[model samples]
Structure formats: structure tokens, C-alpha cells
Target: MTEGDSPMSSIFAAMAPVPERTIADATTLDAAIRAADTPFVVRGLVLDWPLVQAGLKSAQAARDYLAAKRKDVAFTVSVGEAGSNGRLFYDDAMAMNFRVGRGKLPDIFGHIASIENQPDAPPVYLASIDMDGFFTGLADENHVDLGDRDLLKSIWIGTRTRIAAHNDFPQNLACCAVGRRRFTVFPREQFRNLYLGPIDNTPAGRAVSMVDFHDPDFQQHPRFGEALAHAQMVELEPGDAIYLPSLWWHHVEGLAPFNVLVNYWWRDTPRWLGQPQDALNHAIMSIRELPADERAYWRDMFDYYVFGDPELPRAHIPEGAQSVLGPLTADSAGRLRGFLLRQLSK
Candidate 1:
């Protein structure tokens, strides 16, 4: 479709010079992060870091390795972005060339070194830095008291693909190297201006696609101009990193081939109390338990809760009811589970 075709999207361009480069020292990073109000630059984010160094070496070898392994491999597909389940090759668009799963070499994608040597060959793997190691480094850098930040749940994704405008789930510390990547961030409050795409397209259910930055079709989506008034953009290379708060809408893309990105993702700290179900789970509960009439009511309720409304309590919630906000311990979790279980249980 056309740029900014959707009315629910917003765009952010490089509006100012970034914060220049630094060693990403813990003390320096803590301060520099606050100054990154707008999209800014942080050079050498993770180039020398041992984690990224090895991944780049791995990506370089993928060129010849994948050629021999492609016969048995197939493109990994999500529900929507990969086409109507018929697209050729996986979504290597800009992902790092690397492997996944057990002792197997994955059909990774990266910038092809030369065509003369292997003209028909595909790009090699890139962006395969150690996920857990990256986060452990962040936890140490921030001194955030991450009780379990070293768990193996870490994930490092590459293949230079466009991650449309969407909020991240876990807290994110995206460290880059080798090549460059541009990250455009809009405030959480500006979700309205961002014409979001279909959520089912991504595994995380994020809204894919974003409003074009340079030349948006304002005629169709005139409201998107508001997003320009307040936006942030950053270009990250080796040794640079950005602290992405939980659930802040961000649009990210790889600017070059063979770029390296190592992100440290950690779940939010557990709270003392309150129900802790996420928006998606809560949504399923509303849809399944509530009748058609009630379900419609819930749609507006969530819009009011998440969008805008007076019903949202502005005052502090009493400490007693607050414990319900913790997903693992919240009574709402049990209720939500029971609500869904009734249907699945049948």
C-alpha cells in the first residue's frame, strides 16, 4: 500500500544531532540515557563486547554454510507478514544471518559478500550476539537489582527487518554493532497519532508498519502531523545502547546489511500486590466470558482505560487493592484464568 496508508500511524525523522559517542560506561550511560529525550546517536554500543564479536564471525561463515543447508530448510512464517503462507524464503529482509534451535545451522540471511564468488548464493547470517550475556551486562550497568536478569529467556533477533510502530513488552536495552540501525520512537501518549497495523502479523501482536517519515500522505491521515510535533529518532552502532522503557511505542529498522544488534530483554520486576494480567490476556477474558452485548461494552471500556476517559482513577489506589496488579499473584489472574478456563475446559 501507500506510505502512511493507515490512519493510525505516526512518523519520526532525524530532527537533531544525537548525543555523540561514549564508552557506554555504567555511570555515563545512566546519565546519557536521560538526555536521549529525542532520537539520538550512541556510537560503538557493542562492537568490542565479546558477545557481538563472535556473532559477527558466525554471520560471516553463514554464506557458505547456508548454501549447503538450504535444501532441507524452509522459511519460518508468522501468520501475516510472510504473505498468505506462500512467500519464498523466510523473512530475511534485514535479519542477521544465524541459526536457531538445536545443533543445527539455520538458514540465516545477511549481506552477500560477492556475487562473482557465488552469484546465486544468499546473504549470510548477522546479529546473533548472546542474548543472556547482553542483558547481564545491562543489569550490571544499570545496577537495577534485577533478581533474575541472567535467566536463559534472553532473545537476540536480527535479519534487518522493519518492526512497525509498537510498544515493546519486556524492558529493552538494544545494543548494536557492525552495521547501523535507525530507531524512531514516539511517546506512549501519542499512540493515537500512530496509525497502527494489524497486530496478528507479529508474534508479539505488535502493530506492523508506520507512517512514512519524510513524506506522509497527510491528505488521507491529516491527524498524523501531530506526531511530528513530538518524536524521537536514534541511530545506534557498536558500543551504543538505548534504555527503552516498558511499553513505549517504537519503530525500528536496519539501515545497512551485516548490521549487528544485541538486545537485552528482561521482564518487569514483580510487584508486591495487585492483579498482573497483560492487555492481551485481559482482552481474551473479556471476549470469551462476556456475552455479545457485554463484549461490545468491554471494547469501549478498554479504549477508555487505555485510550482516554474519566473512569480511570487519578488518585492513588489503596495499597490493599494494589497487590492485584501483580500478574503472578493477582486475584485477577485466577479470575482471568477461571474465566478462560470455563471455555477451554469444555
Candidate 2:
């Protein structure tokens, strides 16, 4: 069949298009990150990185380059049976459907090499290994010049893998090092329509949408149609990168026999500010199941205290007496934590 007539093409034709922004160098990238409002694709930025050069030669050469830089540290790798079809997802019982095995970098690389030529090999993924800890000098060769910010760099290596749609806490920059990839992103506002699975029990590190992108069961997850209407897609080449804003829901597909991706994750939140996810968990326990009238009261309280004006609430109270209502600093946060622990205990 022709490209336009293909099933995948028909599916993609329905979703919103993701915008692409070509960044020339590190200076342009810095400007983009400073104004981080939406997701954008960066092309030609990492064309000169050594890893990209390695990938251009061959997949084996790329593997060799990474294997040469391997350190003696153990990291977790996800192993899925061939039957799973490269998608790391939940089983029928809503439990995680993959096995995690600890392996060193070289061993993982060797496993990837072994399955390189297999027609129907099982999905073996060395997912999210920290670049700084294991592949020490690798970053020096292919790193983003984010200046003084403490950015976490991680690598994802796998063969034709699919990671379910999930939102991350930090802003992300995923650079394709050795193969092509397709990223389907949706705005945070599309959360309700995305049909997210269990929050407490997740397949991967984060809660994933139950609706499968490859073959979505509309009967079971009918609301997912609305999510698709608001979706955006981007395809990345070896040297391409995509910047995802914090809390943007993204579904990732590694589209080659042997794929390697390097991602940088960072957030602009202050260290003194407590994790918003923690507050979400607390709300789930305390507020989620409350009666509508009681929840409505809490909503107004949140608007007045947490979501609304910060300085206005403490305008009357003395600075020292403001306690948890005041600005969050190391001492104030500690006291608030203790107060929360006491409340939870009760």
C-alpha cells in the first residue's frame, strides 16, 4: 500500500502535529530552555557529537564505542519475552509484565549484539542508566552545554522497544544517539482522557496510560479518542533531539533493531520547595474520596492557602509564627515535615 493509505499513516493523520525548532548551537539551546513553554524538536544540534558519528558508521561501531567506555557498575535492565512485542506494559492482572535483571554495561551491550540479527528476538532493554556514574567520560564527548545547572544525564539502549505513555516530574531533552525514534506527546491537560492506569502500582517507574497506542481498544478506553485528537508526534533521526516540558505526557517508540538514546532531565524548581508529587500522594490519601461538599470546602482552602497568593496569607501573622504557611526554607520545611508526620500518625 501507498504511504498515505497505510494504517499507521491514517492513525497519525488524526493527531495534532508537534512543532520543530532547529537549534544551531549551545547558545540557541540555552535560550530555548530559558523560555521552556512547550515541547520542541532540535535538529543538527548533536550532529557533531562522537556518539552520533559512531552511529553513522554502523550499529556495531556504535555499540563498540559505548562498550569501550563501560565502567564496572551494575545497573538494572528490563527483559521482556518475544511475546510482549517490545512494549513494556502491564499484564492482564494489571501487574508489571517485565522482568528486571542486574547487569554491567558490557554484558548488556553483548546481549544487544547477540540479538542484533535475530528476526523475532525478545525485547531486552538497558533502560535509563545514569551517564555520570557508569559511562563517566561518555558525557564529555556528547553532553549538552546547560552551564551550571545540575542536569541528570541518562542513556537508554534497547532493540525496537516501546515505553508506554507516562509523565515525568522534570523537563526532558531526549537525544537520539544510534537510531530513529517516534515520540507521541500530549499536553498535561489531557490527563483525564488518557485513561491512566493505577497510580500506586505502575509498570515502569511512573504510572502509564492503559490505552495502547499501537492498537488502542476503543471499547475499553473510549475517552482515549479525545486524547488522540489533542496529541502531537515527532520522529527523531540519529542526531535529532526533542525537549519535553515538565509533566508533559509522552509515549516513546525506539524504531530500529538496535537503538541508543541519551536523555538530559532537569527542572527549574528550587531545592527548598517540596516535591509536588508528595503533595499529590497526600491529597490522594486525604482528599480524593471525601464527600463533594467537604471536597469543595477543601478546594476553596487550597485556593486560598496553597494555590493562591502566598504573601497575602502571612501578611497578618508574625514572620516567626507563620510556620508552615510562611516561605519554605530548610528549617521551615523540616518543621512542616515533622508536623505532617505527626498528623499522619494520628
The top-ranked prediction according to lDDT is 2
Q: TM-score for each prediction?
A: 0.57, 0.93
lDDT of 2 by residue, 37-110 (tens): 78988876688899899999999899889888888778789888675557888878876677898987778878
The parts of candidate 1 lying over 4 Å away from their true place are 1-42, 51-160, 210-215, 271-339, 343-346
RMSD each, Å: 8.6, 2.4
The lDDT of each candidate is 0.48, 0.84
lDDT tens digits, residue span 1-346, model 1: 3224533234333343334555346567656544544434456555555544544565454234333423333333221232111111224453312223322223233223432133222323323334333333432332222244532223233333454567865566676644556677767778778776445444244554345443468886576767666666777754566667667777666544444555656554644222233446557655868778988887787676556643354336665565433224555656756765697677
Off by over 4 Å in 2: 1-9, 342-346
Candidate No. with top TM-score: 2
